[model samples]
Target: MANIMAASMYMKIALVCMLVGTLLFVIGFSTVSWMVSSAYNRWEARGVWKVYSCGTSFCTYLSYGAWTYFGRNDYEHVRATQALECIGLIFALVSLLVLLLYLLVDSCRRRNSLIAFVVCVFAAVFFIVVGIAVFAIKLGYSYHVGWSMGFAIVGAIFMFVGGIMGILQLTCR
Candidate 1:
């Protein structure tokens, strides 16, 4: 009985961490400021330039002068960046769904829940890492990482920690 209670506590903590991480991921993914081009000149000064994924195929760039540009134009790097971001978002959502299912189904099999949570957490971490890596590599040369990237990184860390906690919970059983 005590073991089950301990597992339950761990599970609850993991769920809360995942929930907050998911929210942060969503916010980061939606924002246009993953990277901002630094200001260089007066007219050539790209003031507060920001880029954001619009879909798997395209992204939007907002210039310093309030001008917005949209188009993939067959840019492979841009497409890849967008795709990765989308994948990360999907993984995070799926993880959240699995955690919620574990919570909702009173008759849920413990073994199944354990496997599902582990897989979901790992998958989420993988995608989030890859996505952020691609984004950083592609833009790091020309732009500075922004708050959105920071949020995504922090979210990834939370998700990873939550996964570890979930795994520990299983062992406690």
Candidate 2:
């Protein structure tokens, strides 16, 4: 009984953080407010998958495979950012699922499984930071950063903290 109680504390903490990270990743990935442009710029808001035009009220969805651009460069950087974000989201989701399994299924609470979960969490954070870096590099501080980027950054920080707690659990064991 004591063992189960002790394990649950750390596992629950990790699960909650992973969940927040995954949710933030989704919100940031889909929202059209990653970079809000100034009055001088042509676009009003920009996301990984969509762009809102300052001139027009409508927003344009960026098709992944189409490789289209809106009166600008080829948007090669956008495509790369999209791919990296997708990969990071996948990793985050999978790691969260594994953590859930650890919480619900007794057999999955082994040390090896915990190690794998931590590895995936680290990978998710790495890919997400890389994607953000790639996106930021494209504009080079010309546009103002928006809430979407902030969400992603905070999400990564939460996940990292949770992973550290998981490590503490391991060390304590």
Candidate 3:
């Protein structure tokens, strides 16, 4: 009974971390500040095109000037990065579902939950890492990195920590 309780506690903590990470990832992925540059006036500027934006923000997923800068290549790269971020978000959602099952399903197999959680965590990390790599390769040299990148990195770290906690819970049981 104590073992079960301990595992439950760890799983709960892991779930919290994963959820926080997912939220951070979403914010980071959508923001246009992933890459920043400074003006002569010392003002920081972000890329004009981003994965998500509104008219109020004066940014879009693709802008007319993007084609002027790199033609179709920039557009394609941004689209691909957006797809990878979406995949990471999907993996996070799946992990949340598995965690919910782990908490609620008394009769569910423990091994299945362990496997599912681990796979989801790793998959999320993989997608996030790839997306960040692409962004870095495509834009890092041209512009300064910004808070969005930091947020994504921190989010990935949180997911990694949650994965480790999940593993510890399984082993302790």
Candidate 4:
């Protein structure tokens, strides 16, 4: 039992993060989808681009696939899942980037809105930077399995918080 737990630490952490991210994505998507659909139904509302939220919803699920793969701890599985995770990361990151663009475009109408935009930008950048730093250290210390997993857990936690914020904004707004 101890050996099993020891072997699956990374998997356990990854699963926890994935579950949290998935829940946030669902709430965020539902809120945004409802808002946009209602606006369209009203006919008085003009078209608004919301591709970022849409993309995030899709990629967030893919992250689950990656987490499953990573949990398996098979080299081939990890590689495949890592690729998917990276793609999902790209989509997730792009979603945040697009939100920034939307904020920039509409910056004239709202003063305080920029604050949320800035926070989102900061969160996204922090996640990306932490992920890169963790991966870099992992590469350098290839022999240190436990240490690398620790860094990965930190990165995953950052992503989880960032994702939750991304979703919360959709509903709150």
Q: TM-scores of the models, in the given order?
A: 0.75, 0.85, 0.78, 0.32
Candidate 2 lDDT over residue span 46-144, tens digit each: 778776655555445454344334554577788898889888888888788877777667778778878888888888889989999999888656687
- List, residue by residue over 80-170, the lDDT tens digit for candidate 1: 6667767777777777777766666666646787778778788878877887776667544656777777778788888888888878877
Compared with the true structure, the alpha-carbon lDDT of candidate 4 equals: 0.36
For residue 122, model 4's alpha carbon misses the true position, in angstroms, by: 17
Go through the candidates in order and give the C-alpha RMSD of each one to the true structure.
Answer: 6.9, 3.0, 4.6, 22.9
- What is candidate 4's TM-score against the reference? 0.32
Comparing 2 with 3 on TM-score, the higher-scoring candidate is 2
Selected candidate, larger lDDT, 1 vs 3: 3
Q: Model-by-model lDDT, in order?
A: 0.66, 0.77, 0.71, 0.36
**Model 2, residue 124: displacement in angstroms?**
0.2
* lDDT over C-alpha atoms for residue 108 of model 1: 61
Candidate 4 lDDT tens digits, 115-172: 4433543454354444334433432322222322333344445455554554454454
Query: For model 4, which pairs clash?
Result: none
The C-alpha stretches of model 1 lying farther than 4 A from their native spots are: 1-7, 42-74
Best by TM-score: 2
